[model samples]
Target: MAWSDLLAGFAFFLMIEGLLPFVRPDAWRRGISILSEMQDGQLRRTGFIIVVAGLALLYLVRA
Candidate 1:
């Protein structure tokens, strides 16, 4: 894969993350941002879900 593809993926992730504060200002504000707003329990659950989903998607694509 080309470096441009990796850069493009990184840029897309940034654009989505940047828009989260804009779109959900209450749940994610300026000083107390999205990253800081997480509870440890919820964070763990969400992280698990994301990892599972990504792995499942990759499996489906490859299989």
Candidate 2:
């Protein structure tokens, strides 16, 4: 709820987001290319699923 908490979450997200590309740059680029070819609706649904999953995880962890 605090700024510090939000910042910490952002930092964690950055670290996690960086991991795949750091470990396998070619695979990361391939994934990005695939994503770029996806339709808008497909991308939106995928993003929505990810958001819901993240929220579910947060709820379980905080519970």
Candidate 3:
């Protein structure tokens, strides 16, 4: 993949990640609080699932 493609993807990620806090700051704070209360094991599992889901989506789109 090209550097431009990588940069574009990172920019899109930033835009998406910024949306929730921009649109609903209270909800975003609540979500962060909940995440902070999670146990390490639970957080790790959740992160793993998210990563796998993203990879699967990328594979489907690219393939």
Candidate 4:
């Protein structure tokens, strides 16, 4: 894989990883509970949104 792609994936993984320790456990559980309540269609739509945002940012900075 290209270094840029590798770095971008690492950055996004770090973003998600960083959130866990910073947020309170109770708050995190509540958030996950809310997420679990979402319909499959809604969850799929959310997944697409996240993918698009990541790709757009990656394309903007590609060298």
Candidate 5:
């Protein structure tokens, strides 16, 4: 609820987002390449699913 809590959450998110590239740059590059090759609709659906999953997790954690 506080600004500090929001900043801390973002910091954790950044650390987690960096892990794959830090640990396995090649794999991360390959994944990005595959993502780039996806069709627009496929990419949209994949993004929507990811958003929904993240929202569901946030709801569960906050609730």
Candidate 6:
């Protein structure tokens, strides 16, 4: 992909990452607190799942 494509993707990612906190700060805070209480292995597994899902989506979208 081009540099502009990469930048645009990053911008969209930032916008999405901000949505929950902007729309419902309380719920976002609660979610963050819940994540903070999770065990390391659980968090790692969650992260791995998210990464794999993202990659799968990107592959499907770009294919």
lDDT of 3 at 51: 100
Write candidate 6's Cα lDDT for 1-63 as tens digits: 999999999999999999999999999999999999999999999999999999999999999
TM-score of candidate 5 on Cα atoms, chains taken together? 0.92
Name the lDDT of candidate 4. 0.89
- Give the residue spans of candidate 4 off by over 4 A: 1-8, 11-15
Clashing pairs in 3: none
lDDT of 1 by residue, 1-63 (tens): 699987997898899889868888776666466657889997899889999997899689769
User: Each prediction's Cα RMSD?
Assistant: 3.7, 1.0, 0.4, 2.9, 0.8, 0.5
TM-score of each: 0.56, 0.89, 0.98, 0.71, 0.92, 0.97
lDDT of 3 by residue, 1-63 (tens): 899999999999999999999999999999999999999999999999999999999999999
Candidate 2, 5-51: lDDT as tens digits = 99999999999999999999999999999999999999999999999
* Candidate 6 global TM-score: 0.97
lDDT of 6 at 17: 98
**True-vs-predicted CA distance for residue 9, candidate 2, Å:** 1.0
TM-score-based ranking, best first?
3, 6, 5, 2, 4, 1
Off by over 4 Å in 3: none
What shift in Å separates residue 1 of candidate 3 from its native position after superposition? Answer: 0.8
Of candidates 5 and 1, the better by TM-score = 5
- Global CA lDDT computed for model 1: 0.82
CA deviation > 4 Å runs, candidate 5:
none
Q: For residues 1-63, write the lDDT of model 4, one tens digit per residue.
A: 799988998899999877875877778888889999999999999999999998899789884
The model with the greater lDDT, 1 or 4, is: 4
* Candidate 2 deviant stretches above 4 angstroms: none
